[model samples]
Target chain A: MKWKLLFELFVVFFKIGPISFGGGYAMIPLIEREIIDKKKWIRSEEVSEVFAIAGTAPGAIAVNAAIFIGYRLAGFLGALAAMIGVLLPTTAIVMLLGSLYFLFKDNALVEGAFLGIRAAVVGLITYAGIKVARTSIIDKPTFILFFLILLSLLFLHLNPILAIFIGALAGILTMTAKKKIQQKREEKTHFQNKQIREISK
Target chain B: MILINLSLLFLFIGVISFGGGFAMIPVIEAEVTKRGWLTTSEYTDIIAVAGMAPGSIASNSATLVGYHVAGVPGAIVSSIAITFPSLILILLIAVSFNKINQSPLFHSIFYGLRPIVTGLILFAAIKFAISNGLIASTFSWQMVILLSIFALSLFVLLYYKAHPVLVILASGIVGAVIFS
Candidate 1:
């Protein structure tokens, strides 16, 4: 890969950073606009491939997407520059907001507003869970996994990370087991059909 | 010492933060809550501030929590720590030309991971509910206010599909009105 045309990469991501209003997903179209539509940094079809990898990767999709594009366009330094550009504005904003919250947190009005916001946050997080669950909890086995994991966290105080590993294991083990069972059943039916045909003969 | 601790913890959080955004909340909640670094209310407040800001909510929360615990250096360390894992992972993938996204093994892993994330987020919601005195063994007036806000927020988010930023802003205003 070519090394270091990183400055232009940095400026593009920096411009793209603040446009992420709703979440990382919302910023995707903008990324599409900048990376594909405007700059033609990568081919249009490859944009989905980039996003798919970005989604599979750990951390925020916006940052991951930027990193992917940067590396493809320039190199290691390009990836680094894009990351800094994406995070630079937002980190400063979070610090500023956080500092202000600390300053005013003691005031009665501020405290009250937080109380309402806190309750609402609970609501929002629940909404997010449900949104994910709509697609995740499709089958009986999945429902069981969902319930078990939730129980483990709430009661057993299982490590959340550990719970995640268990969930992945359960998915693979159960899915593989189901496939094996189906294969065996099909083989048995085939043998039974052969025997019945011979008896008829 | 605190910075070191921040880096290690956030680095781990960064790697496991699959599905991204709110999906990672319970992991952050469990970690910070376990360490007793911040109270549930304080953490909830961090989330609120983070949600209002642009960019990833989880990353922003990490920044706020780090700041709250140990000031600006803490913030920088934690932010970088949370982000570093993915940067390295993607960089390696980009360099290697490995096709992880297209592989069956990777898809199976995510298929399993997704539901677990769903459960974790729900657990986070319940934690907030219980900690804030909203869900008690016995009822109280505080429960009523909390439930009211909770219900309204859910309704707006679900039915109207309002932007989360708007929902948070409205909630803050309501909090100031009622609590003041």
Candidate 2:
């Protein structure tokens, strides 16, 4: 039974590996359908949460999502199974194509095909950006933060790692301040209620 | 020596690539060019190949570069190195996920991080568009065709909600017909 589950995990991700073109976010809906709708392995909400965690993790979003799902379903070995499965098809295809590309580097047909694919990739990236922004830029603070990071990256040419660090630090400070202000308001309301009670008495 | 360098470089790229595959391009280009493995034009070719090929562009580029520098072993090593850090980190996160998710600090960090990641992705898109000549200093029919393709792709993705693989396949066909 254990071996079967591991094999199942591998098969599921192997199926996803090839068709997951355009990048990691493109794989999310497919993963949702497979894991939630078809397999009944996890619920819809759980999948979204997994996507959130995957987005924040250090690797490719697809790989991270696969690992989280695999680990949840089985354990460490399952995660290993899923990771390899997800990577295997793409690796094989890339190796084969890489060799062929070197041999036919000057081919017009290949070059023309890439000319179109590259433009489509730009579209793919833009779509991904819009999808992420829809979920992420929900409030005034987040909207401003988005523009700030964008401008810094475009003009100042800040490192992405530094930007992430600044975002984290800024988040912590702003959230802490908001919490403190909320607490102060609660305390003031409590004191006012006590004074009103005493006067009535 | 090349193998060691490739592994270490990609491993570092993997750890620092918080925004995902597209965001890794600038760093990868800088390192690969600095190391003298591939020339600037060749590196651009690799990016194009990686984008066209199946898999993450980051991993695909690393594998190709590895193969170019060393051999099959280099490819395996680089690929493994690129993916290793994330596997370890994700496993740790998976194990302690409940604890992390429950923390207000974690929530706040993600709240800020999400928009930043979005910006990074947008930056990557714009960079790619300019480099690929989809956006150029002077306009041409090629630019018009590419823009139309981009618009069609975006429409199909957002409205029709077509699978990306299908979109890529269709775009390849469109290229073959128009450019060829």
Candidate 3:
């Protein structure tokens, strides 16, 4: 029974490789169908939770979600199975294209094509940055963090790894502080209400 | 060997890359470019090709970078190295999933971490724009042409919501016509 579950996890993620077109965001529906509807492995809400965690965790959403769902199902081996299933097909496809690129990269026409593609890449990455900002930069504080971190990268010569560390630290400190302040404000309001009742009495 | 270096680099990348594939770019650029394993232009090309493939663009690019540097063995090593950190981290987190579920502290950390990733990605885009000569130190006709392509691609992506592969291919054809 355990082995069967692992195998199923592998097969399912292998099938997921080709359909991940558009971007990682687009794969939510496909995962919903395979894991939630067809397999009944999880519920709709649970899938979103998984994707949320997947999105927050480091790595690609598809692979992270696969590992999460697989571990949820069958533990360690399930994770390995699902991750391999995800990477195998992707690696093969990349290698095939990689070989062709290496072979013709020196050709003038290919260089032109690559030049144009590089320009487009800048656009795509920027678009992706905007998409992330839409979600991550919800408040003024978050926007400030985004701005400061960006400036650090561009001017401060900050290591990207350090930026990630600092970012997580900032998130933890500020958000926790925000929650505490809100708690205090609520407490103050509650205390004032008690005073008003006593005075009236 | 260089292969070992490659593995160590990618493994580090897998750990630090919060958010997703785009989040991985600035780190990959820093390490890979420093090592001279790949050039900025080549890195951009890998991103484009990886986007066409299924799965994570980050991992796909790692595979391409590996192959570009060493050979088939390098590709295999990079694929494994890039993915290994994810497996370890997931296993650890999955075991403690219940604790993380209720931890407001954990949630807040991600809330903070994400915007940093956004900043990093924007940094990467700007860096690539400068490095790949889309925006150059000394302006030229080629720079103008590249900027136009960049503008057109960004416009189509944002306004029309066109598929990225089509945009890449369309840009390639435009490049072929103009440059070649």
lDDT digits (tens) for residues B99-166 of candidate 2: 99899998888788778878887877776788788889998999999999889988998999876667
Candidate 1 C-alpha lDDT tens digits along B13-106: 8988888778777788878888889987788889889988888888999999899989999999999999999899888766654566566667
Contacts from the true interface found in each model, as a fraction, amount to: 0.83, 0.69, 0.81
lDDT of 3 by residue, A69-92 (tens): 888888889888998888788889
Instruction: Determine which window of 10 residues in candidate 2 chain A has minimal summed lDDT.
Output: A105-114
Score chain A of model 2 by TM-score against the reference chain A. 0.73
Q: Which prediction has more favorable TM-score, 1 or 2?
A: 1
- Could you give candidate 2's per-residue lDDT for residues A92-164 as a string of tens digits? 8888888887887667876777678777877877887898789889888889888998898878977766776
Off by over 4 Å in 2: A1-12, A22-56, A69-75, A184-201, B19-22, B25-54, B68-71
Expressed as tens digits, the lDDT of each residue in B45-103 for candidate 3 is 88888877777878888898899899999999999998888888877776777798789
Q: For residue A98, what is the lDDT in candidate 3?
A: 84
Tell me the whole-model lDDT of each prediction, alpha carbons only: 0.86, 0.81, 0.86
Error of 2 at B97 (Å): 1.4
Candidate 3 clashing pairs? none
How many collisions per candidate? 2, 0, 0
Best by DockQ: 1
